[model samples]
Structure formats: structure tokens, C-alpha cells
Target chain A: MQDLVKKMATELDLKGEVCPYTFVKTKLKLEELESGEELVVTFDHAPAVENVPRSLKNEGHKIMGIEQKGDHLWKVRIRKA
Target chain B: MKLGILLTTSPENENTNTVIAISTAARKAGHEVSIFLMYDGVYNVNKKDFAELVDKGVNIAVCALNVEQRKVGRVEGILFGSQYDHACIAADVDRFISFG
Candidate 1:
């Protein structure tokens, strides 16, 4: 039903890094999110499979979606409770 | 609710670990987890070794079309035949998320 598609508008940005580090930083921010809150994380790394979403879930956060715009830029959305 | 995690990258890529991290976390939080592997991600299942977290029951749903295109052997457990579709994925979960 795409119910989670409803955008809630929260933003978090992680810069100047690569794998594991980008994910590590993103996890730190998710700790502060409340249920149904949305977070937008901007990252420069090319491989997102291992870090971003994983770290979010590790902290009990929900990753709404991820969009890659051009090369070297990605915007990941997360919802935390 | 159940969740669908899309993995479209290869194991060699840095993103593979991120996908694993997210899937493991989802399972730990008590959410049903399934992964759809596409593009380079089809190779993830081909790997013989995985992290320790994989031992703990992770649901993996692979993209059949992608698998056939790559002509990889159909592995058991971690990989599933394309008989399952995205409609199945969306219907089977509370959330459908992608990682590329």
C-alpha cells in the first residue's frame, strides 16, 4: 500500500567519508529520532549497501527509501521512533 | 510488520556490508525481513562465506529476472527463485526499502 511512503520531513547529513564511517555517523543521529520521524541523509560514498540502512536498523530505525542522484551523491530517508 | 530490503550491489562493493547491517537490525527489531537482489547484487548469494549474523535466520528474496540474466546457479536458503514477485514482496511486508 506504500503507507510508509508518506514523507515526514526529517533531515540528517553525513559528509566527508566512506563506508562504515558514513554508516557509523548516520547511526549516531538516528538515536535522536522519535517514531514516525523521517531523516534525510546525504552521503558521498558509492557503496551504500553495507552501511547506511544497516546502521539505521542496528539502532532500531526505519529506512524509508534511498535515491541516488548522479554519481557520488545519495539521499537516504529514515524514520525513527 | 514485514519488510522488503532491496540489495542491488555486489559483494565486492562497500555497500554490501550496509545491506547486511540493515537486514540484521531489522530482524533483531522483530520485523520480518526479505531481500530482493538485483543487478550486481545477484552475486551476493553466490558468495560461500558470510558474516556471523547470517547464521541467525535472515529472509532473502532474490529477483529471478536478474538471476537468469546473469546465469548463476540457483542456490538454496539465501537465494529464492523468481516465482516470487514484487507484488508479493509489497504485499508480504509493512515496508519496502531499497539499497543501491
Candidate 2:
């Protein structure tokens, strides 16, 4: 069996960006996409892994997935809503 | 939704970051945002990051009284308005967030 990969409409690498900014940049990118489009954002800030998803969800966006890619890095898949 | 952000503190305060963060997020969410800067918050009009907010299309207005008190002349990108403008912002927006 094989897991299906979700296609991302856009991607952001915020590896060195901090909290709020991690979410801030993600929010900005989401605005540039059409509704229902997907965005993949990678960041190393631990708090953002939690904060970004919460904030985005609050704004009515959908969180497709969150994966830990390394000791300090994580990736979030979001579908604009 | 239309959003109103009232900022009363200067950039020295941590809430300034909150102001920037929230306004940026609100703008990106396709909401119209108006930020009313009063008291020491007027000082933030010159900060580098604050300029980004203006560029992001957040309507920024500084209190005319505070601008005069601080001896700040007209700033290019910021609007100098009276308390009436602030009242209008409060009345117009569907949601308001305050950072002091």
C-alpha cells in the first residue's frame, strides 16, 4: 500500500523565522492563493508548529497535516478556506 | 470581516509586536484593517516594520493630539487625524483589537 501525497499550490520555507512571523508570513502567503488552494509551510520554530495551525484554523482555514521533519523543523500543510 | 486595531503603546512595548503581527495577519486574511495609533503608539509610525503594515494596505492613522505632543511633523505614509477618526474606525469595523 502507498500513502497518497497531497499537492501543494504554494510552499514557504520559514526555517529561521520566529513565532507570530512564522504565522504572519504563512497568513500572507495564504492570502495570495485562491480559496480551496493548498499551501505547504516549513518552519523550525517549535511554538509556531502549534501557534500557526491554531491561528489559521481560527481564521477558518483548514490544516491538512503537520509533520516533524527534523529535530527543530516542521512542515504544515494548509488548505485555504 | 472589517477589523479595527487600536494601539496605544510605543514600539518599546512588546505589544507593538502584537499590533504588527495581528494587523499583518488580518490584512492577509482579506479583511479591511484600520489601525488607530494614539498616545505613545504614534511613535511607531517611523519603525521599519510598521512601514510594512502600511505597505500591506492597513489604514494607519495617528492621533493629531499625540503627534503635536511628540512634536512629530507630518509623516509621509501616516494619516494625522483627530479622535473623531478613531471613533469612526471603532464604529465602522466589525471587530476591534486593542494593544496597549
Candidate 3:
């Protein structure tokens, strides 16, 4: 079998939150990432979908993917670029 | 020459003012700008009240999925789509800036 590569994952759970706070918490967590590292953020706000990825993209980070879990929950994958 | 702006919050909230400020500033800088709205941001373009920004050449785009989620149809000048609408703007623009 081929070797399996697992990237380091950091999850920031900010369920039941709002804007700016979600952005701020995610940013602080992202600050700890090295280039190429991955962060998985979970939040319940739809705005977080736009705000978090947009904020990260503006800061020169890469958005790997965004996944919506349930009615109010989402998972955003961001890579430090 | 082109600037991609994303507003992810509602204007009813004070937080939305930041997005407007940035868009206003970009216009003052003389760049062609368009704003894509998603989530609560779809509400920002629910009326013609922001006509000044439109007059300034800021095209408004709202996420289609978000519009349905929020049940806000019949809003003028706000198109419905996914983040791709916004991403395309970012792809073609000289710069992408987002405010929430």
C-alpha cells in the first residue's frame, strides 16, 4: 500500500457566534500556523463562510475548501500561504 | 483597474459600516469596483437605498444560495449565486478586499 500522509490539523470551534468575533478568533488561531499548515474552523454563522475565507484570502492565506455541515454549522479549511 | 469587494454582513448592523467604508474608499481611489454579498450580506442590497454606491460603479452580487436561505427575493440589482460569483470577481480583479 502507498504511504498515507496526514497533515496537521487545528480546529477552532466557534459555534453559535457572530461576525468580527469569529473573524478575530480565527485570525488569532491562524497566526500560529506556519506556511503550508492547515486550519479547520467550525462556526454556525453563514457570515463566517464569507468573512473567514475572505479575511484569510486578503491576508495572503490559501482557502483549501469550505464545507457546510448542518443548517447553521460549517467547516472552512484554510492553509497558511 | 478592477477591485473585488465582498460584504458579508447586513447594513442594519454597525459592523456592516466597515464594508461600506472600504467600498467608499476604493471608489474615492478611482478603481472600478463590484461587491459580492453572501450570508447576511444579501440583506445589504435588499433595497435601492445604497444607490450612491451603485452610482459610484460598485456592482452588487448576492449569493443565490444565501438568498434562498434568507428568503429574500425581488431585491433589485442583487444577483443570486454561490461564493463563485464573488470568487470570479476576485480572480479577475487587480485586488480583492473583504469587509464584514
DockQ of each: 0.02, 0.01, 0.04
Q: Show the lowest summed lDDT stretch of 10 residues, model 2 chain A.
A: A1-10
TM-score for all models, in order of appearance: 0.48, 0.54, 0.53
lDDT of 3 by residue, B19-83 (tens): 66777888898878888887788887754555357767678877755676788764544544445
- Winning model by DockQ: 3
Per-residue lDDT over B23-63 for candidate 1, one digit per residue giving the tens place of the 0 to 100 score = 77877888777777777888888775433434656766565
Tens-digit lDDT track of model 1 for A1-81: 245544456566665665445665666676676666677888775444334575457557777778887677788878775
For model 3, how does the per-residue alpha-carbon lDDT over A1-81 read when each residue is reduced to its tens digit?
111112457788999766556777887888887877788899887756876687678778888889989998899988888
**Per-residue lDDT of A1-81 in model 2, one digit per residue for the tens?**
112336435889998886446767888899999998889999886656765786688679999899999998899999999
Best TM-score among the predictions, by candidate number: 2
Q: Give candidate 2 misplaced runs (Cα > 4 Å).
A: A1-81
In candidate 3 the C-alpha lDDT for residue B30 amounts to 86
Fraction of true contacts retained by every candidate, in order, equals 0.00, 0.00, 0.00
lDDT of each: 0.66, 0.81, 0.74
State residue A61's C-alpha deviation in candidate 3, in Å: 0.7
After superposing candidate 3 on the true structure, give the runs of residues whose Cα lies further than 4 Å from its correct spot: A1-7, B1-49, B58-100
i-RMSD per candidate, Å: 12.1, 14.2, 7.0
Superposed Cα RMSD, model 2: 14.3
TM-score of chain B of 3: 0.79
